[model samples]
Target: MKQIKIGVFGCNRGGDYFRSLLANNADIVAVCDKDDFWLNKAKKRLGDGVAYYASFDEFIEHPMDAVLLANYFNEHAPFAIRCLEKGIHVLSECTAAGTMAECVQLVRAAEKSKAKYMLCENYPFMKFNREIKRICDSGTLGKILYAEGEYNHPVASSDVAFMRKYKPYAEHWRNYLPRTYYITHSMAPIMYATGANPIRVTALPVFAPFDDSMAISGSHCGDRAAIITTLNDDDSVFKVSGCAGFGAHGNSYRVCGTEGQIENLRGMGTQVMLRYNKWSKPAEMESNNLYDPKWNHKDEALIEKEGHGGGDFLVIQEFLNCILEDKKPPFDVYFATRMSAVAILAHRSLLELGMPYDIPDFRKEEDRVKWESDFLTPFYGPNGEAPTLRCSSHADFTPPEGPMKAYLEAIKTRE
Candidate 1:
């Protein structure tokens, strides 16, 4: 067995994968983060065997075959590009690019690199979601037509602790994140299950700012969620949320086809509900059947011990398998960039009051030419470049001064 050497960037989220990487027989060669707290945490877990660095410039110079990018939500593309430039494999977390130009740059970098790039999107590997894909692939669902996914996570207004930890500073990316930005959790599973690529996207915002009296929030966007709709290459339509904060906290998905429909039961753990017309129900199956899914994976024990319904473990396993086998990952650079395009354009649609935007196919030179110079972004740059665009549907919306002050105070107390 060839042990793949891997380094991780951003220990805060990247450290979560240390055990999984070790379980898959990958050597933890190096780890890097700007924060001493996170770097020290990684040191504690990986022991003194791994080299640690506080500067990414020096970290990337370390000898490693691949790098797992679990950095900030909006800053993966530039780092991934640098890795690809060095012929280092990349397993990126979540949305691949923060802007259209970065999307173009990422595609170009991957095309020119010998090493592969994969989006570490784990939602598709969830037990029930995998079952949904199985049923879809089995032809029991007939021709897939429409699907829906919702990732609702609503924190309590009084959870100042969360604000202190995640949104520690006013200029943090999370503080300025649009409702449609954190989209992969709700978008990837349906795309994987149905084999659909989004061609067009539009969205509407669910605007409901938190009460300043109860919550200490520094988030610039007041929208609770973005209801995004996509028209796919397969003629199927997908409706999903972008990290919603509405109703109850749950991750739900549904796939409806010509003959039948299936959905994972929210608040019911791994159980799924499958339904079909009497004439369309398959043999030995009821018109309406509900059951919990079985893992049936070789790494079931190790997977069960991990997070995200065991998806975290499977994602690492798949990435390593791809590397060792000299195969491209299913969630390749193209797939990742496409998802980022949908997210970026969906937010544009929300700002435009639901004006649809065509998703460009970066594989086409014409499409790449169209967006190569489009660098508009809603995030502050590392050098403090101001955002070129607004993040919220309400362009003038900002957290009240009282809440902002309280939020800063809470973070200071934590320090």
Candidate 2:
């Protein structure tokens, strides 16, 4: 097998995949990052053999077969387009594009380029999620009618260390991230399992800002979660949350159909609960069965050691397989853009007090034209452009002055 030469951008997050990439026989030829701390950290893992650059302009010029874009959350599309134009395969991290305009541009770039583009959505590859997909594919679940996914992640407001590290500057993307902007983790698994494409979306915010007495870290967003509901092409409904903050930290999913339903038991560690009507149960099967899922993959040993419930390893493996086989990935450009559309539009729905928005299908020229000039965003741009949209549901809401000052002071103290 020819070793695939790959470059990683954004060392902090990208470094997490070093072991998995090596285990999959990929050569890490180059790495790029703006932060010297993270760059030095990457050096410790990759040693002196790998090329390092602080500028992507120079890094992208390196000879490589593909690039894993783990850059900023809202900045993958432009870089991915450049990789495609250079005929290099792109494995982009979550939230493929920041704006509708970029989504259109990415779709066009992928259509014209010879290289393939894949969204690295790992949650769909998690053990229980894979099992859910298997059951859904087997037709034992009957006609799917509804599904739900929650990626609740709550952090302590007192964790100034985390704030100093992740949301370093006031203008950082994380500070202005809307409740519905990080939807892939909560949205992708259900979509993948049931093969449902969301056509319409509506959302409402759970506006629970951190207490004024605590350090609010200069974050513009005050919403703890966004309850987003989508109407799929299959006429099914799905309810999901995007990086929610109002619950105990855990991911949970449930899929219900005409005759049966299946869900991963929360806090159960890979256990799944499958239930069916007595009359609709599979032959000799019980009406309800709860059990732990099996990895069942040849790389089970290696996968068990990887992150995100063994999803990180499987996602990379799938991306490499697609490149080797000269095939498009399941989460190809279309799928990625669709998810981004849901995320962007869902936030707009929240802003409008739950007004539904139609998700554009980039494959169609008409749909592409509709969003071609839609560049509205809730985040600050690379050049420090002011946000054109509000990050929180309450337009007048801002981080309290005292908390913001304390947050900044805490960061300075660490420095």
Candidate 3:
């Protein structure tokens, strides 16, 4: 077997990808991290055969066929673009990029690069989601008219304190991202199901009035936000996401078509419902529960012990296959641009008070070039003006009381 040499950036979240890579017996040539704490840990886990580097510049020079970008959610694009420019394939852990400009640059870079780029959105590869996609693609549900996806994550106060403790930098992307920015986990699956991209979006964010978190963390952004999106190729309106401190524990999705519908069960069960017109010529209606099913052995050899319901396994396998076969990944640069643009436009819609914002087709050169100069991000430059709009009320930040403050006092990392 030809061992495809791979390097990974960001070893913390990179663990899952490493495990998946190991399953395929890929040659783990290198790993990189900004922090010595993480880099040292990765070296211990990956062994002496795999090289480690604190600087990405050094790691990029190391021999590798592909790079798994499991870095900061806001900072994948620049690194991925570099890898592609160097003729190294890249599989990005999503949001794809931070700003519209990065999205535009990413698309343009991949278009010119010989190496392939893929957005590793694991949600669509989940057991139920794949089943839904198969059913929809089979035309069993007719035209998918409406769909809903929600990822409401409640970050505990302690977790906030811990993140602040380790990464005390003021501009750390995780600390202050608006609830609306991380909508890809929910939105990507819906896009995958219908093979459609959201054309425009309207966003509304609900500010959390929790006094403890507000007094402790000073998060001006909301605890929950919702975005309604219209698909371009299909007449489907997708209710995409509500995120951050929404006091919710799980994620779920549903799509209703002209003929039928499919939805996951509420609560802590893996039950799902599938309703459709039976394929038989009798024109009969059928309803079936999708649970306790047989295993899908499509990528049996490579994706056996994968994460995200074998999605992590499948996505990496596809990336490898695309590299070997010299084909574009299913979720290539265009798809990444579209998904990232949804959040970008959604946040813009919130700035305009739920007004609709148009999502440009980045596949077009003109549409992309116009956004090339737009470097809007959650973090600000030395100049007082940050991005186009500051999501937080306080431009200057103060560490919150209790644990976060104690961490600041005890161990100061950055900023």
Residue 27 in model 1: shift from native, Å? 0.7
Expressed as tens digits, the lDDT of each residue in 139-216 for candidate 2 is: 998999999999998888888878877877778899899989999999999999999999999999999887568555
* Model 3 misplaced regions, further than 4 Å: 160-168, 213-220, 242-244, 277-285, 288-290, 298-305, 380-388, 392-415
Candidate 1 has which clashing residue pairs, if any? none
- In order of lDDT, best first, we have 2, 1, 3
For model 3, residues 1-415, the per-residue Cα lDDT tens digits are: 6778999998877866887887767778999988777787787788888888888999999989999998877889989999999999998998888889999889888889988899987877776777778777978677789998887676555454555443555455555576677877788877888887878888876654344633434343434455555556676788877354564577788988887888776564556787665553125444654563334665665554677667788777778878877787888888888878888778777766688877889978788877889887765443444545666433343344554454344335432
**lDDT of every model, 2 decimals:** 0.92, 0.93, 0.74
Number of the predicted model whose lDDT against the real structure is largest? 2
Residue range with the least summed lDDT across 10 consecutive positions in model 1: 406-415
How displaced is residue 33 in candidate 3, in Å?
0.7
- State in Å the error of residue 269, model 3: 3.7
RMSD versus native structure for model 1: 1.0
| Better candidate by lDDT, 2 or 3 | 2
1-415 per-residue lDDT for model 1 (tens digits): 9999999999977988998899989999999999888898898888988999999999999999999999888899999999999999999998899999999999999999999999999889899999999999999889999999998988877688888768767799998999898898898999889999999999999999875685778888899999999999999999999899999999999999999999999999999999998999999899999999899888899999988998899999999999999988989988899999999999999999999999999999999999999888889998899999999899788787777777888888553
